[model samples]
Target chain A: MQATPALTVEHLTKRFGGRVAVDDVSFTVAAGEVFGFLGPNGAGKTTTVRMLGTLISPTSGSAIVAGLPLSPANGVAIRQQIAVMPEAPGLYLRLTVTENLEFFAGLYRIRDRARIPAALEAVGLQGRATDLCGNLSKGLRQRVALARALLNDPAVLFLDEPTSGLDPVASREVHGLIDGLRERGVTVFLTTHRLEEAERLCDRVAILNTTLRTIGRTDDLRDRLFRKRLLVETRAPLTDPGSVFDGSPGVTGWEANGSGVYEIVVTDAKLAAPDVARALVAAGADVLSLAEQRHSLEDVYLELISEDVEATR
Target chain B: MSGERIRAVVQKELRDFRRNRFLVGTMAVLPLVFLVSPMITLLQIPASTPVSVIHHAVGGSSLLLFVVPAVIPPIMAAYSVIGERDQGTLEPFLTTPIEREELLLAKAIAVFLPSVTVAYGIYFAFALTIRFAAAHAVSAAVWHTPQIVAQLVFTPLIATWAVWVGIAMSVRARDVRVAQQLATLASLPAIGITALITFRVVTPSVRLAVALAVVLLVIDIRAWRFVSKLFDRERLITGSRAKPS
Candidate 1:
């Protein structure tokens, strides 16, 4: 049996003055799934997060966050069940780390006195609990903010650019903490402009450019956007390569990318790789290597955003 | 309305205010500066002073004391909303389960406690100094029953009014300094009303003072409800209201 979705947004739109921030975008996030919301700057990623997090009301349409309808009357109830970590760490610079988390813990009214220390331990900041947030590095402050978000043990955590400006090591630490949350079966709705972060941590990702351009698993998006191709590299140019490669199983088409490099379009690389190798050997081609060409999430994101750039042009 | 949430806001605000050097400087310096004029005025009164002359001098000094509560709270309360926004903390704060009423009340109580304490402290210190140091006629004039009651009752009410004004300006002003300045300017009217009473322009009486305190109380409560309505999440977040799609 399927549990209820953690978030259900239908025709959710937000406009500021004459500009439309998020335009009629709709999506659902399943329970315990790590969903990534990827978009460029001003693509309404934060606006959507703000709408779902109950920080701002939508201009039109509706949503159900953590099993509660999104309305002014239900705003507090919805907020009680979810946590949103905005792009800014937003910590009180003068307050100690424990004080910051304790304040939020008090807001969440988490009766368990142990949760503050537990949250600090979760973020590896137990020793720095008494240190002022202003004294900590940017990375440490982000961790403290994350600990504050974890105070409620929220059912759905909406993280907006959780690793936006961190160093690679700090980013890795945060990624690990996200992994820990996933292991605990917590549903995470992460919004980021970093495609690699989404690719590494998200179960599914939605690409938005004002409106949602596409939404699917990263590999699925890659497959859906570009055709599968096997890259063949030979030591030297081959004579009569067409005859050698013609009628090969799973080889729909072929083209010479360079003198010794051929790009082969294949229905299935597993089926065509062995046949292509045998044909290349039979044709006396010195084959240096043959491998499937893969596309990264960056390529997919750029493809979608570039399309947006083109449509406006 | 969740006492825990209110307590949390109050705790966080007081903690922040305690550590802020500028706020501490303002809270410390303003009351002391306001106290000096009244202390000097009472010290100058002579034993040979007539009853009416002593009454006028005490009334004028009491007006200066009232300015302590009216002015100091606007400075502190003005920082409550715009300060959080200036530091980028308001968004995370609003995302919590805290209602607007709870936040406003907590902020009011936070400023109210310190402002009223300092105001009352200054008042009591002045009274004690008058009892020991001032001439007999001046000390007796300062200890008038109606005057004592007015100071006791009006300090919190005036501070409460200044707080709501300051918070209202904080909600609307884009910058913290500007909010504080405007809130200070806006709260002067509360002092103006007290000035009329001190100068006997409205013919002071026990019934009149009570009626006016009730009126100030009603305004403070309405101001709370009004400021709560003015606290728009969308406007604060985006600096603009949602336009029709």
Candidate 2:
């Protein structure tokens, strides 16, 4: 039997006055999967997270978080099972790091006295446990917030722009921490503007723009949205690379580089690479190398967002 | 209501309250004046003074006692939710498992305890000062009369009413300054009515004291209900969007 999904959001929406912030957004996160929610500013990423986290009630539709259905009666239970680290670190600046964690542990009713220290250690904040959150730097404050979020050992975690405004080293530290959470079978629902971070950590991602545009595995999205490309290098200049690709079944178009290189858009690079190489050699051009080019998640994201904008317009 | 969560929020608010110099100064300085100034003025009155003068002096001191509970709660409770929002702490706090009523009550109690305590403490200090300093002139029965009932019964009720009003404003007002101003304004009606009784502008009788306490209690209940209803988690989060990022 398949395991139950940790979170299921169906047709969730939120409206502020007459303006709809999140419109009919829907998705599900499986147990222990790192699911990324990506969108531009004002695209309802935070709104959707807020609804799932039980911070705000949905204007319409429903969701189930950690087996508890999202409703007014189940808000407390849903909050108990999931933790959200908002876009801001949102730590008590005056309280010490240990105090902050202990306070939340108490709120979570985590009776284990050792859990406070364990949470601190989990976030690598044991050394700064006694330091005032106000005295700590931005990155350290984020760590404290993470420690607080882990106080309950929640089944599902919501991290919104976790690494935003962090230096490279601090961002890496957070990435490493998230990696550790995934290894421990924690379901992480992450919202971020950084495509690279999502591409690196998320098992699958859902691109949202007030509504969900697409949801699938990262590589799968790239495959579905972008065509394959193959680069061919020859020992001599391709005087007429178009001639080689003209009648090719799989080749859609070709562009010649200055000297011995040519870039070809193909229906399937894996299937077309060998054929193109054979055709180049047959055409009396010595084929130096043939390689396939993979598109990045950023490309797919930009392509989707621009398409969304154009369609809306 | 979860007792543990309420306790945690109360503890954290208290810890933060300690760090605020302005609030601490107001809590300390204002009560000091109200408590000590009455004693000083009572001490200056000669023992040879008439009974009417002594009664008038005690009545005047009782008015100062009313001021403590009225003023302190607004200063503290007004800052509770809005202060957290200003400090960028409310968002994470609301995401926790703690219920909304638990969070609001914990904050209200955190402000309520110190405000009422200081008020009553000052009243106790004033009574002691009057007993020791004006021993020959003022009778102990004067202190033990309706003023004691006012301190024990009416002060807390009024303080609670003020706190609930402050919390209501804290929930509705986006700016902490605006919340504080509104709370201060809300405390006026209660304080004004109490002042009338203390100054003999309204008759000081046990029945009047009981009647005032009952009325304040009713208002306190309504204020609590209003605060609980006004504090919308969505509004608090979305309202901050209008603030300069």
Candidate 3:
């Protein structure tokens, strides 16, 4: 893909009367990037998506999505390049799945009537196409909605909490579908409360609280904020092998279980682990097992949110 | 603006209307009852009265003429618009290529056309009743160029007004039930007029009714324009405060 950002927000601001939802927020999403927008609810994630999708106009700033300006007149053009899946399933419940597809196909200005059949097949709704939308299960309805969003073969896809209320199986199906989209070079902007979703799907993430808190590669962001903690299990415990080099570096905290195992939390591991082993040997404790606990993405996410909340207060 | 697109939209609406057999039944029953009830009532009128009762019933026909077209069309149009909305607004055409305006307009027509058909059927039935009443009892029906003009010209204008009301309410209201209630509420003026005619509280004058029709025509044009503004898609999906201007 090219180097240019597929989506750009310049000095973006959205104010709802007295309160500002998105305040001077600016970010860029690179071409074909799975850009994750992680924010607590009511952090203007949905607002920003609506503006970028051209559903709502921005209060002050401007956004260029798929190389098209976001304006009502340019709605069709912008919409042609991006598909938006709102928080709810905005569908025609009365129409059968086939009829619903036919309707949206016309809306997208797709003339070939036959593509409708293929589109239904793409979502694995070929059999249910004849069924009324109201009769379908919530998971099935969400699939139909995703199918409609894909009608135009858009370059950018906006999914607003795509799996928020779905069962695990359905959520996995959706995640798999999104993963396939990444392979197909489609840029995805997703707003999700599930931090794991952002961790798994996003190449880069921007944590938004009141404004853009921080934006970067997920691993980089996590490392920049919190030190990596690892969980390791050794075959046997270390029995007082320390005092060989008591002041060793990178290892701050160490504890041992009574069995042939030891639990270790290290900060400066270069000096600490070696000396701790020697000290354990001198103390006559057998080095049977060792283990380190690894910090998770959730740990980083919670840390960031807490930091932001603290800063706001 | 595309013919193909417009045709597609119209077809979707027709599909909805066809599926709503309850609405179809109401359209048939209302028109048939209104048309046949007056004739049946007239047939029972004393046969001993002069056959010239045809001329006398002209007054009744004039009153019925205004009442039938003015009252029924608006309420019927409203009901139809609201009825389609019953399936949760999104449940119907969110996926359709048709613009919201075109969809609303087409639905308005769906509501209007059936209403006019029922009203016209009532008029035709009344006319037939007048013929039968005159030959068998009193020649109460008055045949005049003006009466035909009233039915052909003014009745259509009235139907258009009703369609506008239904469309306006349909777009403004969130669901079918609310739209139907609001549309039904809109016909209060016609109902008030009908009550006046029945009570003889207001004189049965054709000129006043025609004047009301003229005023309604102007308001109808303005309402149509205003209604389209409500279909502001941005405000519909995004909260109104979302847009800058």
Candidate 4:
């Protein structure tokens, strides 16, 4: 049986006057999964997150966040169920880290005061709780925002550019914290422009450009939008690389570049690699290396965004 | 509205305000000067002047008391929403479960308490200076007249009016400086009305105080409603590019 999705957005749209910022975008994020929302600037990624976080009302369509319907009527309940770490850390600079967390705890009406210290500990800021937020580094301020979000123990967490502007070590620390949240079964809706971060952390990703151009498991998208290819390097140039790939069950096409290299399109590179190597050896060619050429998420993202831009133009 | 949420915002704002030395200095210094300067001038009045004229001069001094609440709250409240927006804290704050009413009321109360406290403090201090420093001429009866009634009753109403106006300006203005300037401009009418009473252009009477109080009370209700509407989540989040006319 399929578990009820943590969030389901159906044709969610937002318009600013005559301009439609988010145009009929739809997707679902299952419980405990990290769903990355990737888009360029002006692609309405922040607008969509604002709508889901109940900070702004959608101009049209509907959504269910953590099983609660998205509407002004359910806004308070929905807010209680979800927490958003906005693009800016947005901490109260004058207040201490502990004061900031405690203030939010009061807003969330968290009965147990112990949760403040626990949240601080969870974000690895136990020692800095008494330090003023303005005095902290940018990375530490981001972690303080994260700690504030967790005060509510929200069922769904929306992290927008969570690792943005952080040093490498700080970014890695945040990634590990997000990993811990996943292990604890908290659903995460991550919006980031960082393709590599999405590729590393997201179970599924949606590429949005005002509208959703594509949405699926990252690996599934890589496979569907890109071709799987095998590259072969040999000791000597092959006379007829087409003959070796021809009539092979999994091989779709083949091309021989000058020198000692050939590239072949395959349905599954893992299954077709051995066959291609065997064929080359039988044809009196010494194969030095055979490697699969997998497409990165960045390649898929750029291709989709450019295609959408061209189509719109 | 949840009291807990309102209290939370209020406490946090107060904590933040305490750390803002410039704001604290303005709130403190202005009221002290406004209250004490008049007292010094009134004390220097010649003893040869008629008792009725001294009485009138002391009555006019009560008008300076109105400035305490009027000036302080607008300065503090003007910074309430627009300042938070400039600091980037307003977005995260709006995302919380707290309602709009709770957040605005919290900010209003944060300014209201300090403004009223400082205003009343100056009032009593002014009264003491008259009692001890000018013991020969100015009688306590001057402090017990209709002007005193107006000061006691109408100061908070005007302060509340200033706060609501400041909050309204803060919601509409894009920046803190703009909010402060607009709030100060909006407050001119209240100060003008008080000035009329101070200069004897409009005499203070029980009926007049009650009438002004009633009018200000109605304006307060409307201002509160206007502020509540202006703080719509969509407008605030979008920076209100298309401001309501």
Candidate 5:
């Protein structure tokens, strides 16, 4: 039998007064999956995390987090099964790293003294456990927060903007730690505005702009929102581009983009490439390069957000 | 409800307080400042002074000591929740499994322990000084059984009231300074009642002191429950209340 998903949010909505922060947001994250929640500022990504983390109740709809129904009654049980690290590291600045983790361990009611050191080790901060949190750099503090989240050995970990303000080096350190979490098969629900971070780290990402704009694997989203295409670069422009490409198999249309470059719209790049290439040779054209075009997650995100902006206008 | 969680919060709070220069300075300075007036009042009492004058001086001195527990704790307690919010820690702290009641009680206990300790310590030091260093009549007036009992009984009760008031203000106020100022202002009423006992508006007797202690205890317990309800996680996290489903 398949294992139950780590998170099941159905029509989860949160409104503050007349403003709807998160509207009808629903998605499921499979066990051991690293799911990214991406959005712009005030896009309700944090609010949705707050709801699933049980820090706040939803205005409407429901969710099952870590196998427990999301309700006030199950808040403690659900919290016990999951961990949330907000954007701020939130470590008590005066306490030593070990003291911070020890305090959280006590709250988790974990009798084993081993988890503290283990968590510290997991973040590669074992050597710095004796240092005060205030004395640590921003990167090290973020690691300590990650260690605190790991103390309970939670079933799901929710990280909201885990690397919001860090420099490149610090951000890279955090990215590496997240990659390690993925290796351990931990179910991680990451919320971030950095598109590249989501693209590199998430198995699937959901983009939200108050409501969920789109959600799926990055590749799948690219495929869903953009048509398949091939970019052809040649030594010379086709003397008759339409005659060379009009009857080609799988070739829907073609556009001359630049000097000796043709952007061919295709049903399938694989099926169309051979036919188009053969036709080009017959037309006495010199083909420099031929490859399928690729679109980054950023393209898909911008496309959806621009559509929303236009609709609003 | 978990003791471990409560202990964790209390432990973290105390550790944080110890390092906080403002809190340490407030805890140390307020007791000494409140103590000085009482100590001077008791010390200046000459053996030749009238009985009534000595009684008035000692009663007034004793009343001033109540200010320590009442005023000092509000500053600390008021900082508790709002301080967490100011430092961007409240969200992560609330995300834990600890209940609001446990968090408030632990914060109260953390504030209560030090405030009550300083209040009692100052009172004891004052009483001992009066006993060994002051005039016989003044010392006797200060050492009266009902007075000593009232001091012991009401100090924690008063501190408890101040703690709850501060926490309530912390929960509701948008700014830390505003919360602390309001909490201090709100806590004066607890001391005002004690002042009535000092001035004989409410007679000073063991029976009356005990009865008043009971009343304050009930109010403190009820205040804790009310503050627990006032602690809206949704409001704290989002700066707005969660709409009802």
Candidate 6:
């Protein structure tokens, strides 16, 4: 059976003055998938995210979020099904955190006030429910925003720069909260400049610099950057380790150090690791640290964005 | 508007209004200083009015009447959209299932309720003072007219107009203070008319009052329709069009 899409954006276009913020962007996010949007500053990620959350309407394109059309005509309906945590803190500072939750839960029409405690618990803010939102630390404020979004038990979540200004520990807490949303089958659409964040949370990502430069699974991007290379070490010296692999396949970029430690770049290390191991044994070298090394998502992210500038230039 | 949706929206708006002690107190204070302070002086005039005393009293009274309707609403107008925008509650409130009007309805109530109520309260206190001034000496019809109007019809209508103009200013201006200034100016024309009438330039009569109220009502109708259009959630959020690079 085919999976249903949680979001469908087609030819999404938004203009600010004569500048195109988001131009002809089209993509579909499947239900329960964590879709990451990576971009440089001013790359229109927030604009796109805002449009999806129904906080703002598009100039001339269509979006279907949670199977409802996203437009001024149907904004209320679309908003009912989606949770949006904008980059900035959005809450009532005067009201205590619990009051803020109760106010929103009331808007969402949750009859009993008891449910607010549960919502607060989810964000680990139950203990601080009575504290004023304004006086809380930045991370606590972020969680309050998150808890407010989750009040409606939305079908899709749009979190824009959720961990942008957080300390490392706070960032981890927020990251964990976001990761926890997956268990409820909420479709999460996120935007971040941090490549590691995208790698850790997103199932797939699109690198956007003014427009999409490249998009795919993280490993697929890794492959485009470097060949599959594994490290193997042996005794002090080995002469011509590759001399045994006369019939081995796909070792195009071959380089082996003279310390009986060999490294051969292969397209697929699974097939090549065993062949290289057999050859190393034949060469009387004991195998050690036979681990595969891969390129980090950060390297791939930079490589993709810079390539766009180069191509445009 | 669906009943549940309206309630949901109203409950939230009222909740926010209740949460805002500063706005409530500020709304109450602006009118006290502007309207009640003047009304107290008007009630101080003797019933056996000296020619000079009546002239100054009547002139100031009419100006207060004009401003009572025009000026206070504009002040109230600042509280409409600017408060919501400044508070960062605009998007969340605007996106709810509640119809825009329901939200505005509550906001209208929020602005008008305090302005009109305080005006009436001041009128009530001023009325007792006027009655004391009359019983202690003499009473005149005009001396009590402003409070009666403030109580019966003029205050409510003025509050409505104030809220209407306020909604527009709040939507159009970038911030609450600016909106407050702009919306407060909505009463200028009323003040001008009162000035013309006060100088024996034009007599204040039933016909004049009705005509002026009719014109105001008509302008307010157009303003009502126009202000709702400005209440667009999209514009309030990203602001006006962005400059393209």
How much does each candidate deviate from the true structure in C-alpha RMSD?
A: 1.4, 3.2, 5.0, 2.4, 1.5, 3.5
In terms of lDDT, the best-performing candidate is: 5
- For model 4, how does the per-residue alpha-carbon lDDT over A1-313 read when each residue is reduced to its tens digit? 1389999999899888878889998899998898899999889999999999988778888999999999889989999999999989999999999999889998998879999999999999999989999999999999999999888888899999999899998999899899888887889999999999999999999999999999998888989888999998999987877787886779999887769887899989999988888888889998899999878999899999999879979
Please, what are the lDDT tens digits per residue for candidate 6 over residues B1-245? 54455455445555566667776676566656765665566666656667656655656664564455566667656766777778767766655555666666666765666566666776565556555653233235445453244235556666677778788888878878888887777646545644654544566565666676677668667766777777766678878742222
Candidate 6 or 3, higher lDDT: 6
Give the per-residue Cα lDDT of candidate 5 at A280: 88
The candidate that wins on DockQ is 5
Q: After superposition, how far is residue B151 of candidate 4 from its true place, in Å?
A: 2.6
TM-score evaluated only on chain B, model 1: 0.96
| Residue-wise C-alpha lDDT for candidate 5, range B57-151, written one tens digit per residue | 88789889998899989999998998999998888888889998999999999999999999999999999998999999998998898888989
Model 5: how far residue A159 lies from native, Å: 1.0
Error of 5 at A313 (Å): 0.9
Give the per-residue lDDT digits (tens) of candidate 1, residues A56-134: 7788988999999988899899999999999999999999998998889888888797999999999999999899999
True contact recovery of candidate 3 = 0.32
TM-score of 3: 0.80
Per-residue error (Å), model 2, residue A161 = 0.6
DockQ of candidate 3 is: 0.33
Better of 1 and 6 by lDDT: 1
In candidate 3, what are the lDDT values of residues A109-217, reduced to their tens digit? 7887777777677778888989988899878888887887777787788988888889988888888778877897889998988888888888888988858888898
How far is A225's C-alpha from truth in model 5 (Å)? Answer: 1.0
Question: Could you tell me every candidate's TM-score relative to the true structure?
Answer: 0.98, 0.93, 0.80, 0.95, 0.97, 0.87
* Every candidate's TM-score, chain A alone: 0.98, 0.93, 0.84, 0.97, 0.97, 0.91
Alpha-carbon DockQ of candidate 5: 0.79
- B33-111 per-residue lDDT for model 4 (tens digits): 8987878878887667787787678756877778777778888898998888889998889889998888888999999
For residue A260, give model 2's deviation from the true position in Å.
2.7
Tens digits of per-residue lDDT for model 6 on A125-242? 8889889887999899999988888888888888889999999999999989988987667788889998889999998888776566677889988887767887777766566654
Q: Which residue window of length 10 is worst by lDDT in model 5 chain A? A: A1-10
* True-vs-predicted CA distance for residue B192, candidate 6, Å: 5.3
**Which residue pairs show backbone clashes in model 6?**
A16-B242, A17-B242, A19-B244, B73-B162, B74-B183, B77-B166
**Which residue runs does candidate 5 get wrong by more than 4 Å?**
none
lDDT of 2 by residue, A1-313 (tens): 1289998889888887778888888899999999999999999999888888877778788888999999878888888898999978988888899888878888898889698888889989889989999899989888888888888888999999999999999999999999999988889999998999999999999999888989999888988987788988888897677788876779999888769888899988888887887788889998878899878889988998999899989
